[model samples]
Target: MSTLQTSINGADSSVAVIIPSKPNPLTVTYKDLVTECSSFQHKLAAIGITNRSPVSIATVNSYEFIVSFLATSWQRGIAAPLNPAYKQDEFEFYIEDIKSAIVLVPKGAYDTDAPSVKAARKFNAAVAECYWDNVKKEVALDVKDLGQLKGHSKENILQAQPDDVALVLHTSGTTSRPKVVCHRSSQMSVIDVNVNELLC
Candidate 1:
């Protein structure tokens, strides 16, 4: 089972992702989160990121970041998360390296001086300003469909393969030029095994 399914099958009603903007805590169940993810998936389909092409998200800590990331994963897109603190040269190099199709930003966070935004524009990729609050309202997954999708949809859709590069963590070059280290999805198991042995 995918990580998403495991979370949903083991859901708690009181479980929630803390949204800092709201006065009161926004409570969302694992089931609800999955539904929201699916809805966002459909939204992406409507917007045209599918198995053929993928979208990339660029953000600092904002509710949009979580939603967009989940949505992209649900849509079987390659998610390239960039450091929100990257400088102009680093940002430009990373964007070019990943060949990102889109850059998702918060509703009003766009700055001409922002390195990621400028790099995104330079690459001729689309920039989407997502409103987390609005997305929560409009994009919600169907509760009944969740079980079915969880059981089969993930498998039927292309599961990111062992060789598929999940993310690129750019080295923070305090002394020299930044370079990237590609991380493949399958290597996670190896890391987990090694960590378990060390802990034990």
Candidate 2:
């Protein structure tokens, strides 16, 4: 199997994502999705996000989250999706456990001094707000604090290897400390293929 990055190709004009909104639902074509993801990936690389860098994403289900998650993986970074509803302590635990290089939150998260932001700051992890700018017509990565990436030179855009860790998830620490799980690039690709096959 191939990596998720390499497998994310399709007919250009085909609908790749849709977000239901109040006034209208947003639709994204494969061309737009791929293009935006690559652009974001470049931004990530510019900020020193390299292979295996843990990128904790604390945004909810939205277009920004999709772009950030996909872009992180495309840049060969480990995407760690966190629940936005998580408490400060929970966020701190996860962020520290993963040694997250950066934490992505919704727009204005910095101004609000969000819990995720606080937790990231506490651990010296970088913090950035990820959001879709209607005027800019693209995803914006507003770096509030470079933290860990401070003084780190720009990183080159890297390709995802089949064995590279693409995603990191955790089990709810109901009884004890949460356990971490790593998913390889090849495994993600295979899962995507299987899901598509089932749909077809």
What is the alpha-carbon lDDT of model 2 when measured against the actual structure?
0.86
**Backbone clashes per model, in order?**
1, 0
Candidate number achieving the greatest TM-score relative to the actual structure: 2
Residues 132-174, model 1: lDDT tens digits: 5554464322221111112222223333345545445667788
Show the colliding residue pairs in model 2: none
TM-score, every prediction: 0.66, 0.93
Superposed on all Cα atoms, the candidates' RMSDs to the truth, in angstroms, are: 8.8, 2.8
| Candidate 2 lDDT, 65-152, residue by residue in tens | 8788778888999999998889999899999999999999998889999999999999999999998888998999999999989999
